[model samples]
Target: MLNIPLIGLKADQFRHPLDLEATNTLKQLPGLDLMVRQLLGQLGEQFFMLENLASSVQVGENQLPHLHQLLVEACKTLDLEVPQLYVRQHPMPNAYTFAMRGKQPFVVMHTSLIDLLTDEEVKAVIGHELGHLKCEHGVYLTLANLIVLAAGQISPLGTVLAQGLQAQMLEWLRCAEFTCDRAALLATQDPRVVASVLMKLAGGSPTLAPKLNVDAFLAQARAYDDLSSSELGQMLKQAQTAQLSHPVPVLRAREIDRWASSKDYESLLARSGSVCYDGETKTKGGWRNW
Candidate 1:
């Protein structure tokens, strides 16, 4: 759980008040922590507590050694020590990280995610997952996944309670995602790269990606803005993303595109220094900074 060194490490440490407010709101809620503690074991076992790490045909040292190299390079660039990474067989393009404070951390990437993305886009995904680790989002996201899976098991009125709480969580998840996207930007030090990843995720197919246009995708994002501005647009948006886990891909693409060019993103990179993965740095000196 890295503290992100918001103040001194980067000039772009503009903590979104919404992000802070959400964190505070979560803390004030009674029993959620206790509930998570009771439930985490059941959930963590699905991935974190497995008997053996997934066998990979390749990793940083072998197989797609190129990707492994990229992962190591990204970690080095971000001043983060390399964590173990795994690729799993799955159709959906995705990645996730799991770790608790003082625990071993690791990341998983779906084969499909890699299949559809370019090497640079893949780095953005790696950086995005690293964003979770940097922001200490693993524990919460881990528990949230469990809660969603167990949503229907709460006995009577379980569905209602689950739906209500899930909506609250979805809101927080969206904003937290934004914070992590910034982390990815910080790692890559290139908004266009990050934005291009978003663009591919939005409309890229295996066959369509060779010709995918970053500018056209951005234009689509701007078009989305225009579309969402009208009266029908508001209703459409409310209907579209009301149930989504991640923010809409175009919206995320648009956001990264905008933030990439902002003074905030650049300032963070300028202030951030080169990191050596082989060396050690004090993690945090304060309380549960998350």
Candidate 2:
């Protein structure tokens, strides 16, 4: 294990622009951290307890060795410290990253999602989850999911608190997800791989997964982007994103599409030279200047 300190990567190195802006916006909200800490004690417990968690396949050398290898490879690429992985048996093709302020952190991937993607695509998803940990997103994401879960399972007062907290968490998460998508992009280096993962998640199964077209799906994403270019369109854009926990999938794809071509994404790779790229760090793009 490379013991190099990765904390120096900083927000500028890999965090998505929207995630950066939303995080700043969220910090301005009153008592944000207090609300987060207060709520995490309750919310954090479910992630660890057997009764609260649904079925999950924990990975190690003994189980899912292929996935274990992918996790190790992606972690090596980004210089992120590896966290434990849990593959939950869920029909939904979804995955999530978990972390607290500092105590416990891990990533969860749905079995269905694993079944839907290729090995490379799967690693991209792991990289996406790792991006959250890299950026310290586990705190807000935990609190947000908890607020929504609490609202549904508890009393009226809980509903009010959950509504307020969930809205904020959703707002933050939507952007954070995009940031992590870039992490996936960097890991896969194939925009099609990233886009296909989203498309499959939108609608896919073990049977239909093989036929999904990455190019056609990317076109769909580009078409979706065309919807927000006008004055009324811009208003709808604001309304559209204001309440969602994730950017609509197509929007996310388009964002990744845009970012994959941007100087920011290129610079990070040029400097970091991924695990597949080189051994000695060159500090390209003046990364050392940061």
TM-scores for candidates 1 onward, in order? 0.77, 0.77
Candidate 1 segments whose C-alpha is farther than 4 A from its true place: 1-17, 28-52, 55-58, 142-161, 274-290
Candidate 2 per-residue lDDT, tens place, 1-290, comes to 22122322544477777678767665565776667766674566455645324467788788899888888777766566677888887787888876664445678888788999889889889989888877777665554565578676677587787777777777788888888997787666777788888888887788999998878888988776687788888899888788877888888888888888899877666655422225654433212212
lDDT of each: 0.68, 0.73
Assess candidate 2 and give its lDDT: 0.73
What tens-digit string does per-residue lDDT give for candidate 1 at 1-290? 12232322321253344555665666565776556645663556455636226454336686678878878766655556677777888787788877564256678888888988878778778878876766656556655656666876887888987887788778778877777777677656667777777776777778877788878888998999999999999899978887777888788878877787788766665544432245753333221213
Q: Model 2: how far is 50 from its true place, Å?
A: 4.2
Residue 177, candidate 2: C-alpha displacement in angstroms: 0.9
> What does candidate 2 score in Cα RMSD to the true structure?
6.3
lDDT of model 2 at position 154: 74
**C-alpha lDDT (0 to 100) for residue 150 of candidate 1:** 80
Candidate 2 vs. true structure, TM-score: 0.77
